[model samples]
Target: MKTDTIKRVLGYTAPYRLNLIAGFVCALLYVLFTLLGPVLIGRAIDQVFGPGNVNYQGVVFYLALLAVTVLLAAAFQWVLNVCTRNVSAWAANDLRRDAFAVLNRVPLKYIDGHSHGDIISRMVNDAELVAEGLLQGLTQLLPGVATILGTLCVMAVLNPFIALVVVLVTPVSIWFAGFVARRTDGFFRAQSAAQGKLSGYINEMVAGQSIVRSFGYEQRCFEEFDKISDELYETGLKSVFYSSITNPGTRFVNAIVYAAVAVFGALSAISGSISVGQLSCFLTYANQYTKPFNEVTGVLTQMQTALASAERLFAVLDAEPETPDAPDALEPKKCEGAVRVENVAFSYTPKVPLIENFHLDVKPGQRIAIVGPTGCGKTTLINLLMRFYDVREGAIYVDGNEIRTLKRNALRGMYGMVLQETWLKNATVRENIAYGKPDATLEEITAAAKAAYAHGFIKRLPQGYDTMIEPGGGNLSAGQKQLLCIARIMLCQPEMLILDEATSSIDTRTEMLIQQAFEKLIQGRTSFVVAHRLSTIQSADVILVMNAGRIVEQGTHASLLEKGGFYANLYNSQFAVE
Candidate 1:
């Protein structure tokens, strides 16, 4: 799994392979120039030749050469930084794009089953972690490896015995870093999961803070939040503690190796097998080689955390998208609004059936009202109609064609939906009204707003149609937001409409006006209305009463009232209490 994640993360860099290659080349050049420093300094040391016997000219030449190498190394380092930054930015942008795209493509069931906050965390925090980790790996790991290999080769040519000493001790440090990494991997994974949970909780609390404060549940909310936060803190501390061990442990081993090299090189110098200047160069190479080990070990924490984040991110990317549109999917330009459901069955969970052997048929110009208590499958039926979730056992047809055979966009485009919840983007009132008809002119938008009884209120805004709506329509009243939503559907004038308690947020007077407008709008179009307010659907051509996912009564409102069946009881119970 880790290997697959690593490959996928690297795949995001495919578009920037040139940048990666350039960065690596620059990294190698930087290492090369840096390695020259030790050699030139050693040559200058040899020119010292005790004191009076020193070759001052030779010393000056090597020092000058060392200065030039330093300058070149600095230049390459700057270029390396630029290349890595470009590559990192491109890869991050691509990864985020794919992650977000997958979210849109995946089945709605996947979204309903997951926490919105957790999903956001994966898309935002986790993706960022992966990008940062990639940047650090590119900037540090590659050059560190190059430096180690370069030092080894240089040491071998200068003094073979000291070189052998370094090679033998290298594995100890490598093994220790690997051990620490393995031990910390699970903690990092736990930390990431905990963080996602915390994020999910926070998002829920913030979005529903009004309810929290109203119910005086802030103390309980805080207690739950504290629990999740404590879990995150514990896991994060463990991951940091274990990962932090790598650098110091490896450095301690490297320190021992450094001492050994010094001792061995000193003996070789005394035996006249190596010169003082050569011994100096060997010690420098020894330190240089072990330095990469320290650097690599230090990077292990970020790399492990990134891998954990990548795993979560990949889970999202790897989810099965909505079964792709069939190869020969139909894309009808117009829908007649005729729909049929045949022997349908569905369940959110296999052990608990929700809808079974359900069926419905509607003509092109009929109005069907569905009524039920909460959790009786009114919304589920609508979800099925919209293809948000497919029936498990049967099929639905629209305009004499199986819905699955039609391109989802084409099928959904035929219907305009307004739900109880009103959603408004942070845009001008005109834009919100024209959301369903992007190219709608100002006159068209104004007509729709007037039809929904929203024009009067909109004109009162400081900038009228151009006034920017605050996020979540915080600047607007609930009734006003719903009016805008109703205006959106009024502008679209789809072949069919689904109003799921669409006017629940609006005042009764505005709702009655909107209802009158809807009466004209649905004059020749098929429409489905899900309502608890039985009075609103009195004019529906057919009323279907539902219970436990099954349609238990079917008739017009007057006929159902005469039957005194489940529909009559529901209707009577509601008004009796009122």
Candidate 2:
């Protein structure tokens, strides 16, 4: 799994193979210069401390060679940094772009099932972790390993015994670092999961702040938040603790190697087997030999995290997307507003059906009002119309053609929707209104707003249409935001319309005004209105009173009232107070 994940990650560098190869070559040169410099410096020292008299010229020449090597190594190191940085940048950009594209293609059910905050975390936080890991692994880890191998080879040639000792100490460091990384990997994974849950909770809480305050739930929310925070804290501490051990564990092994090198190299010198200058060189190589261990261990723990992050990123990329358009998918040039639902069966879960054996037929330009209590699948019909979910057992038809054969975008573009909840971006008021018809002229935008009864209030703003609205329609009344949504639909002017309790947020007086606008808006167009207010649908051409996801009664409002069945009772229930 690790190799496959790493290979998949590196595959993104295919477009930058030349740069990556160049970076590796630069790294190789850097290590070569670095390893060679110590030898030349040792030779210069040997000349200075000759048996009878110092060879000053020889010392100077050796020193100069060492200086030039150092300068070249520094320059090569700079090139390595620049090349690796670009490689990582390009890789990260590709990963994030692919992840986002997958998000766009995947079924909405996937998003509904997953925690929103966790999804965001994987996209942003996990992607960043992958980038950091790549930067270190590609630039630092590669160079670090090469440095250790080169130092070991040079050291072995100088003193086989000392080289054997350094080699022996390496296993202890490797084993310890590996042990710590294994122990910490699970901790980091757990910590990431906890963070996702915490982020989800925070997101939900902030969105529902009004409800919490209105219900006096501040203390309860605080206590709940603390519990989640504490869990995250514990997991974080364990992960941090494991990462802390890698540095010290490797250092401990290095100390032992350094001590043994000093003692053995001195013994060799006294036996006249090696000179003081050679011993000095042995000491320098010993430090170089062990330094890579610390560097490698430090980054290994992070590499573990990066791998975990890569695993998450790949999971998103692998998720099943919504069924794609068939090669012969038809794009209808025009649709008459006739719609039919036949033998449709659906459920959020299997075997437990929410809407089953449901059938409906409406002629062109009819106003169909669907009324039911919450959870009775009122909004679900709209979901089906827009193809957010496919019917398990049957089909829907538009213009006498099965909708399943139509391209989803073409089918959905036939309708405009306004829900009870409004969605407004932090853009200019004009931009929000013109979102549906982006190319709409100013006159068209104003005419739509005027039709929706929103022009009066908009003109009172500091800059009218040019005024920027904060996110979620901040600084605007709920009614004002609702008006903006209605104006947006009016601008698009789709052939079929969906109004989902669209007037719920407005005042009764504004409702009366917007209803006038709705009356004008629905003319000569087939519209689906899901309403809780029975009064709003009193004049609907046909009322479908749904109960438990099944249409139990259907007739003109007056006819349903005369029948005194489920529709009459539901209609009566609301007016009982009056």
Cα lDDT computed for each candidate against the true fold:
0.91, 0.89
Q: What lDDT tens digits, residue by residue, belong to model 1 across residues 447-475?
A: 99999899999999999999999988999
Model 1: worst 10 consecutive residues (lDDT sum): 84-93
TM values, all candidates: 0.98, 0.95
lDDT of the structure predicted as candidate 1: 0.91
Model 1: number of clashes?
0
Residue 496, candidate 1: Cα error in Å is 0.2
Model 1 TM-score is 0.98
What local lDDT does model 1 show for residue 372? Answer: 94
lDDT of 2 at 312: 82
Q: Write the per-residue lDDT of candidate 2 for residues 448-475, one digit (tens) a residue.
A: 9998989999999999999999877778
